[model samples]
Target: MPRTKPGVGKGVLHPGAGVGKFEVRRFHPDPDLAPFVEHLWTVRWDLGDAPPFVQRTLPDPAVHIVFERDRSEIVGVVRGRFERVLVGAGRVFSAKLHPGGLAWLGAEDASRLTNRRVAVDALFAGVDVAAREAAILGAASEEAMAVELQAFLRSVAPRASAEAARA
Candidate 1:
């Protein structure tokens, strides 16, 4: 099936925004990780001298790992709508995991994480958080950031339980 274009239904959260102000890119996971991952998305923006932009979205069942310049977090499914304000010039790389994919990361119940944000180290224990953060934030472009993120996921290689597999 052909993938829908990015930003197609994204207007509710980013209304009146011109397409040229920022860039949104999506990528499929590596073949081995496809079942556990829906896709990766990166949003890069350079709104020089423009006012802050507020973006909102309806709740989604999938979990997400969001990487930013100073912090990274494992976000659980949100039961309510989500909102964020974009300020300055920066980018964010995120992994949208399949609804059941949280089990692969040792989460017993994905719903428990709903509306909660956990430190990356809490979910990815033993991984070098600082080094990984540096690599991701230091990437030159969105594509490079995606590559770094995919490599990190591959290195961790979390496994889904039988129930998750069925999901």
Candidate 2:
């Protein structure tokens, strides 16, 4: 089964190609992530540049591009991560970057997600996934040694309930 919701109108990765794999463009400020962004700027500056900048900044690691099939447009985006600070006796420690998972949703779906009401709902579904992974890995809660990871997700929800409903 697909990881995303059911009833999503058959999303095409590349509009002209007409089937199979969608193109994903990775965006990054440094040489590490987005090479295309750099190439574009070499020619000249355009207001069109903003999307790449936004894409480069998102917290999600898996994200590369936002494909709008109808219009055949692609935007760069990163998933957003939720940081949990694991604190202990009289000290601040252990920051873990948890992939919120909801970051993968396209712009239209994600913009609606900002509502706190929706966020809390998704958290209930996704938290267990994170907790279980942490427990399995034996990332024991402790008072020292802070660890911080930066990444992103579509949302914290267990499933794409809202996106599903819309479809």
Candidate 3:
């Protein structure tokens, strides 16, 4: 199930997950985007002078659009576990897509992207991806980042098809 509340990271597997040292939150999609977007999310961590922390989790099989500074990506469904190393200080805003959302959003098929990542431009073409990424990442707060991402998601909602929507 998608997390509907803020400050929750159900998939996070760590001591005192999604709080304090590791901050995360989930925001529900707007009504118009409900079909394609499961939820929008943000993750922030500041390890400061400490050693890098490796985050581990068993992720659900779903597509995701992760927006970072200059490194935004369309992440495909992962069949296994997930891990990412966190260090220093950083934050990212992302959208968790529904099962058929990838196809609806422009990918030929979700299966083609399995265990792979493509530049966000592959799907959301024509937009200034770098500029958009910068705006989202540069937002002053997590809620602001989600708003930026939600606007982007809403911008693409019109292109989705009914068949793909049902998928």
Candidate 4:
């Protein structure tokens, strides 16, 4: 067998056992996924805004993927985007703006997260993707992580009004 690098940032939480207890799938059939995606979109539009990054070629576009782990187990979901900057001739261009997009997929649903290591891994894998993209593009994450958190807060802001009205 060929020698491999150690802890090369494969998102493997565990090393020898091929850590990454979860797997991220493009789109798998799941009864809960629609609702999850709905909750994310309705209560969290930022989460679903990943693909547009690829569409506009925004140098950094958020991408969405349903996460599955344990072969068939449905783990929690997350979003990741990457931004890059092209530095040349004393001028810097924002190649990608938002890496590690907002992640509020199903926090309210404990069935999806907490104790489910696979779910959490999937989410972090999304994070890894963003990070790797930055590394590959020779760009820096800059403040993508911070921006993602802020977006999450903004997304939930609408819920407050709805809750107040109900009361």
- Choose the strongest candidate by lDDT: 3
What is candidate 4's lDDT per residue for 1-167, written digit by digit as tens? 11112222322233343222211111111222222221111000122222221111111122232211112122222223222221211111111111222233322343333223243235333344333323322323223322332233234333433432453
Q: Name the regions of candidate 3 deviating beyond 4 angstroms.
A: 1-7, 15-19, 158-167
Report, for every candidate in turn, its global Cα lDDT versus the true structure: 0.74, 0.23, 0.78, 0.25
Q: List residue ranges in candidate 4 displaced over 4 A.
A: 1-112, 118-140, 156-167
Output the worst ten-in-a-row residue range by lDDT, candidate 2: 143-152
Poorest lDDT segment (10 consecutive residues) of candidate 1: 1-10
For model 4, what is the C-alpha lDDT against the true structure?
0.25
lDDT of 1 by residue, 1-167 (tens): 21323653342465556366666778777665678888888777888989887777787777888887767888888888778777779877888898777777565577788889998788778978878878977887666777788788766655533433564
Question: Highest TM-score, which number?
Answer: 3
Cα-based TM-score, every candidate: 0.82, 0.19, 0.85, 0.19
Residues 11-109 of candidate 3 have per-residue lDDT tens digits of 777746435667777888766577788889888899889888888877778888999877789888888888988888887889998888776665668
Q: Would you list the rank order by lDDT, best first?
A: 3, 1, 4, 2
Candidate closer to the true structure by lDDT (higher is better), 1 or 3? 3
Evaluate model 4: give its TM-score.
0.19
In model 2, the Cα lDDT at residue 44 comes to 12
lDDT of 2: 0.23
